[model samples]
Target: MRADRLVSLVLLLRRHGRLTAPALARELEVSTRTVLRDIEALSAAGVPVYAERGRHGGFALLPGFRTELTGLNHDEALALLVAGSRRGAQAFGLGSALASAMLKVVDALPESHRDTAAGAVQRLLIDPETDLLSRRQVAEEVPDAIVAEVRRAVFAGHRLRIRYAAVGQSPKWRTVDPVGLVTVRDQGYLLAMRSGADRTYRLSRILAAEELSEPAQRPERVDLDRAWQERSTRFRTGGDQVTVLVRLDPARREELVGTALAVRAEETDADGRLRLEADFQDSRHAVWALWQLATSAEALAPQWLRTALRDRAAAIAASYTSQPES
Candidate 1:
């Protein structure tokens, strides 16, 4: 473990260019004294590490000192960098580790690949916090300590205790045997089992987490991909899924399809509009999604949905009716 820490320490400093003892200790999850000791050891081993004095001072390597990298082709290194650049690692509280690994990859790449890949990554953006219209995408914030504890339990195959807040329900404490973790579109889920039944808990909803010493009651070998897929299938099928038929301007077809689970059928209307049968998670979802398209879309089937939309539109119209011009 110390050996790994030593290498990680080097990688962190190399990545950040300079870091204070306290900063290094925090990233390495050690003490400032340990960081000092490590720096001394690295220096004694002729690692060209030096310190600056006064405010804003920290330890740094002499310019151009790079440890050799091995076995990584250009594409592999680029893949790691691109993944690290995204919010996926942040969701799992692995941001620091990812940063260190990214630095190693960037520093170790061949001179030709390093510059080119770095440029490519800089130009390619993935999953920005907001899109072109400046509408922010909501990202669930899980406390670093809680995420780390949950991650430790998942990796060690230990039982986990969590205070969870399920949607539309009160918070409750429960113990689960962690099977694996999955992150999709910046959301994190803990795949686990409770009483031999599969359960998935959103990491953000976990008010707290405790890793227990007891072994997790999980399969000896878990095919995480298959497990997640099976669980997802069950969830999508078991819900109050609502299918809606809608007539929408062809220009906004994607707008409706984007929020739907599936597009069962599609055709052109006599008036040159697009008609689609789309499936949504629930009636509430169906109403909300189609409502966004406003006058451009209409719910053709499900009289209740049309009524709901009519009522909503009527309410809005009533609220603004006869308003004084400012």
Candidate 2:
């Protein structure tokens, strides 16, 4: 662990040029004393590290000094290249940083492995703009400045004031305690809280943002995965959840389940059709999701849904069957 810290300290200086002891301590999640000790160790190891005295002074490395510590194998290098291909990083305003890091990784590879790894990465495509069906995956637009401020607030545990435009509502300003930022299906969301109540805001919906001087009121250490799960559970259960019983083709069972919020019960009919009880956000959500399956799925219960589907089908049939007067 100490060795890793030493290497990290060197890389931090190499990347940022110079940093004060307090800043280094904050970045390394250690105390100023530990940072000073690490500086002494690095100097003792002939790392050419020097410190400036008085205000406006900090530790810095000798100019043009860089450690060639890139020990990535061919596969590791290719893995990083693949990860860098994702568009999700752009939502968080790290696109250029990711690109630069990938370039550095490629340059640091051994001469013999470089060409092979580069050639292999060329054959693999990730997060393509369009799939074989010619359907485009449009990424949500997030202002670079807004994303940067939100990101800083989340990472630095600072309160954030945002001008948010909720769906069908006028934009308004609100201050939130940022828990974390998440990207799902190319859309970014800031999972935060206002007055201890969960407030999940989409990055695209943020018109503006400012990182506040006051510290955020949140846990020092957050388990993002677990927190996301808990929030997901609350969202799925607390909304106007409607249960839909559906009879679907056995083959399309997964398609129906995947689009639903949750499956309450599932069973197979004797004739081989799949019967599922699924929870949806609301009536409209249920109708829209079921419509995608077309004739492959049927809404079994909730007579109103059946009527709505019947009426919709009748309207469609009427449109096609209408007589044309010439």
Candidate 3:
């Protein structure tokens, strides 16, 4: 662990340039004294470690100091390559450079570890047919580069001048106080305030964006996390609100709670049946929850929800009707 910490300290400093003792300690999950010792050890190994003490002071490697990548094992090398292949790597716009970097790391690994690394890479797979409309695409496929810039501005709390193409309207230039970026399933939206109205702009429809020299004031009562969670929950349920009452056995109740659908326990019956009341964003989640329940629970109230659930059940039955016995 200590050796790993030393290597991590070197890498973190190399990536972030510098970090204070307290900050390094917090990040490394170690005491300040331990970080200081690690710094000393790096210097003893001929690494040029520079230390500065003050409100703005921290530790950094001297400009010319670079570490040899001779320590990464097979597992570490494989993990790096796999990370470079994930959706986040492309989303972050790292491009093929990450793949090249991973190759370099793999080459640096010992001969014995290289075969294991190759086998691991071959076994690992990414499901491309799975939701191709990714956040990375949202960032990369805006009508113009300005939309991407506006997303960055919103994240950085900067003001923006944009030519926005509002829903069912022609594009118009506007100066907006960028609020936040919203990603719901396949769609990426920018939340901003214009004049007196709050608006959400579809990233794909944005015509252009320009970051302003001056920063905009952010809302005093903004809850970005809550907003995102609510939006995601709504999107998952297909946007029709319904309250469902279900009676479940204890085992089934536990299983239901483990699902993506948010459920609340209302009461427990005398016969040990659990009564659950849940606010569903739409009929889809309600139907999904019902299917999971099968014959274990009764879905009461909201006639449309019941109808939707029955229709889904019928579809499942229809799928099986034409199947021949093997």
Ranked by TM-score, the better of candidates 1 and 2 is 2
lDDT of 2 by residue, 1-326 (tens): 88889999999999999999999999999999999999999999999999988898899999999986366544343335446446767777766656666777778777988999999999988778998899999999887889989988997899999999998999999999999987778889999989988888999999999999899988778887888888889889986789999999988878788889999898899999889999998999999888889999899889988988889999999988868777
lDDT of 1 by residue, 1-326 (tens): 77679889889888999999999999999999999999999999899999999999999999999876675544344345546446777777766666666787788776978999999988987778899999998878999899989988987889999999999999999999998878887899999999999999999999999999999999999998999889887876777998889999999987887889889999997889988998889999999998899999999999999999999999988888897779
Alpha-carbon RMSD, each predicted model = 14.8, 10.6, 8.6
List lDDT for all candidates, in order.
Answer: 0.87, 0.87, 0.71
> TM per model?
0.70, 0.74, 0.51
List the lowest-lDDT window of 10 residues for candidate 1. 73-82
Record all residue pairs in model 3 with backbone atoms less than 3 Å apart, i.e. clashing. none
| lDDT comparing candidate 2 with the true structure | 0.87
Q: Clash totals for all models, in order?
A: 0, 0, 0
Winner on TM-score between 1 and 3 is: 1
Task: Output the lDDT of residue 4, model 3.
Answer: 82
Flag the better candidate by TM-score, 2 or 3. Answer: 2
Q: Model 1: clashing residue pairs?
A: none
